[model samples]
Target: METLRNWSSLCGYFVFIFLTTVSKDACFSEGSACEAPTSPECFTKNAIETVYNCEWSMNRTDGIVTFDLYFNSKTKFEVFNKTWHTIPEEKLIQRREVFIWVEAHVGNSSCSSPRRSVVLRDIVKYDAPQITSMSWSNSSLSLMWEAPEKHPALTEVWLRGDGHPAELRKETFTRINTDQVTVANLSQHSTHWVQIRQRSTQVKSPLWSNWSPWVKVPAELAHAPEVNVTTKRLNGTREVTLTWKLRSHAAAAAAGVTYQLSDTQSSLGCPCARTEKRRHYLF
Candidate 1:
């Protein structure tokens, strides 16, 4: 019985040492508020540099808390002897996952150590482009834009055109590593709407930016004659004479032009009918 009691005591001592060693290495206790760094939010990349900030907290008031930073499962450093540390740009650009933990030491007590681990997954993202200039000539439209602030290399741009007359032809342009694009074969004398968006192919799981605001190109200039109208009235009767003079100097000289005159009240109420009634006029 004595030998059995001694063996039992020796086993209990070994168990206590094992538990203490485990606690010393990783001391996170139950109910302790330890938060891991969040992905994307914890990592930021800009044109100049990429940075990572590791943050965590502990509930124990009697212990000193320190942090360990890791990248790709490799220990990088112990948070400069602090609870939070910022990984430099050089280290941040190499890895996608960041692991951090808090280590707390409470006085000389046996259960004084605690640890909590946090893992963050992040991907680098590129900025969105902005349209800079637009020009139109004949049936071709040209667009120019500035590249995104970050990850500008190997970018793909999408240009979309929306036109009037519902049945009007639609045009789309897709290009890589280019900042300017010209689209042709657009209908003459019709309004066209255009928008552009871009994404970078530099990283896995690339993110596409939101589409830019719509831009409008007004109806193309007509190559037809200009007309001046004059009205005359006789003093004795409800009779009027209207005369129109056509000027064919600039645009009309190259193309044949014809004109038609119609009374507003008889044909349609007003010029507003051209749009509201979908009236088609030939010149």
Candidate 2:
């Protein structure tokens, strides 16, 4: 009888603890608004808005993490619309980088405390930049990612690829709309994998940090795409209807018939030249 009573009490205590933990998590944002640094009114009364979400690794060996939230603006303060997750380093495949970014939409006003951007990758915990978008054009690959979590500040970005003697492409970010970095004049008809890296070290070799995923790009000098021609006899004489397949969308989709072929090639830059796109016709 005594043991049963003790067990019941322990169960009740555990329930209380679980509820307490959940309640605390639910109240962190509200408490931050009431506490310090964060002005709850940044969403309503000011032109400058601030938003922040933090993610951390309990084990140092874990990989870096990304806390994602649908963002329409660069920075903003909201009652809700925040999320977080941590990724251990072990989960990362090959040699790639993981980034964390927070955006803000300019409020009607400014913040009371001007927050400075910090290097979050090992240098500063919870201080990673935002990845806006990634793409490539011909030999030049471009990266447009968000900058600074809070107040306006100067920033820089770099890129890594398998070019001869692999080098880093750097660019500086000022009070700008976005962070843009492009490494151009690359070889054409060739595909190279790339990743994005950044450093806020104004005007110096701050640090050629690690790279993100390998974003591939076509070779520089862009080959005139590729052309594959085919013809068919008009069910009779030499009156053959000719149609050539080219590497252009307009060429593929002409008249009313759309012709598209997926080549089973190693993409374009795939090391295996055996890679190819299958041909298709819709007349």
Candidate 3:
């Protein structure tokens, strides 16, 4: 019983300390507004938007806490009763400085956050860029992605060779202003994977979008496969056999490889091709 009483006293002391610290750091006074949510951020997801979507974080204290947002002391902007709120396009002047703050109400007490100043046009975050096409030529990979047609943006391209250990794989990053980029000196023997992300160059402070899904780049054929041919005459007929070594290196690294054979005077058939056995290999 004595030990249980001591533990209870210790827990009570911790609770008292937490409340006192929270009151000092999170509240200005007994009735003052609570401190602003932590790391409040506002950003526009598209270039055509004149306002931003803002969000913040708050420690959920003892009661249900509802929030109200304001812009430059204007009328409450859509009391969403949540930590995140989107300002109406016509509510504030664009391309100009605006002050943003938040108010929190719990039970009968209310608290307001310090005002944060920002320029509506400067804080922008775009959506992930989409890959349109990709092609390989002369040991180089060229990729094209879709973005704002007229609004120039800076892009980052990430490329990694296929069929390699994570630590041993070669990866490359390229920064470019155009929507298309060409990376040279890649091996034609191995396939490649690539992803892209971008941010607006016109904005003073812009956030990069999340990376796009990784796209596969198949390996291009570097040269024709070598083969051995043998022929003999038997029973007034000619028989021929052609054999080639399968290349494990290129075949395993590539998405897939296939071969084709054609003759001008004779059409060869095989069991797999379902052609006449007399004119082609039976098996």
Candidate 4:
């Protein structure tokens, strides 16, 4: 009875070992005898039955990288060439660290050798900023913009305003850190063309994004319009022709000024008497 119990225990131990070995083998079978090449240096080069070279490219719009594998033979090429997973949207925008790997199958069979992992780390580029709102008042222009999707290590903005009369003046503000800027001392009653651009310090290279389209801002706010009114009697009618001239066309248009006319009644006792009749006209 003692010998039989010992034999049973030994058999159970052997069964456990066999099961573990089978599980590991099953996992290792996928990339059996397959290894990565060293040309790119992003992946590991190993001594195995088959070797492959890998190449990758970034898709800025989709925010993903497509990896392709080149094998010596057609059979290996068909099995290992596949796109990796799509990069996370937040990770791409934030320019965070990312890792990628691929499994190369050594033989024709899908499961053959242990899978080898390769990794690459990169910093994604950020998109350009966009202007959201703008306003001008009292010869001052205020602009607001939306920052890039990815938070840049350091952001620099550029603003430019071109005044009318070509030679009058051109103003530019550079290396501004904030998303909003107010430009003062602009010429009133004139149209000013404005544009903006931005760059990020997170990137290794020094590159500025494309400038935003030009926008026009008429500097006519806070200034009262100067208007001259004159009246002349017609040949033989009670109607009188009134003509007016505005010193500043831009200011008058922006202010939406309106004119009102009233005729006063004259009497013996009262030299001038106010009349209830009045006419309003928009200029």
Point to the candidate with the largest TM-score.
3
Candidate 4 wrong stretches, greater than 4 Å: 1-126, 149-177, 221-283
| Alpha-carbon TM-score of each model against the true structure | 0.35, 0.29, 0.52, 0.31
Per residue, candidate 1 scores C-alpha lDDT tens digits across 91-137 of 65344434433343334321222232323323343445556665556
Q: How high is the CA lDDT of each candidate model?
A: 0.46, 0.35, 0.64, 0.41
Q: lDDT of candidate 1? A: 0.46
- Could you arrange the candidates by lDDT from highest to lowest? 3, 1, 4, 2
Q: List the residue pairs that clash in candidate 3.
A: 33-111, 33-112, 34-111
The positional error of residue 93 in candidate 2, measured at the CA in angstroms, is: 39
Candidate 4: tens digits of C-alpha lDDT, residues 150-264: 3333333343444433443444454344476677776665566666665555433334455666655545433544545555567753344555554355544432444445555
lDDT (10s digit) by residue, model 2, range 1-283:
0122222464465222222332221113321122112211101011122232242111111222222221222433232222333333233221222222332212221112223333223232213444444344656645566553333334455544456426666655554442666656655555454455544333221333334445444343134334555556665623323355343443222222224444452355655445544444443
Worst 10 residues of 2 by lDDT: 38-47
Every candidate's CA RMSD: 16.8, 19.0, 12.5, 20.8
How high is the lDDT of residue 211 in model 4? 68
Best by lDDT: 3
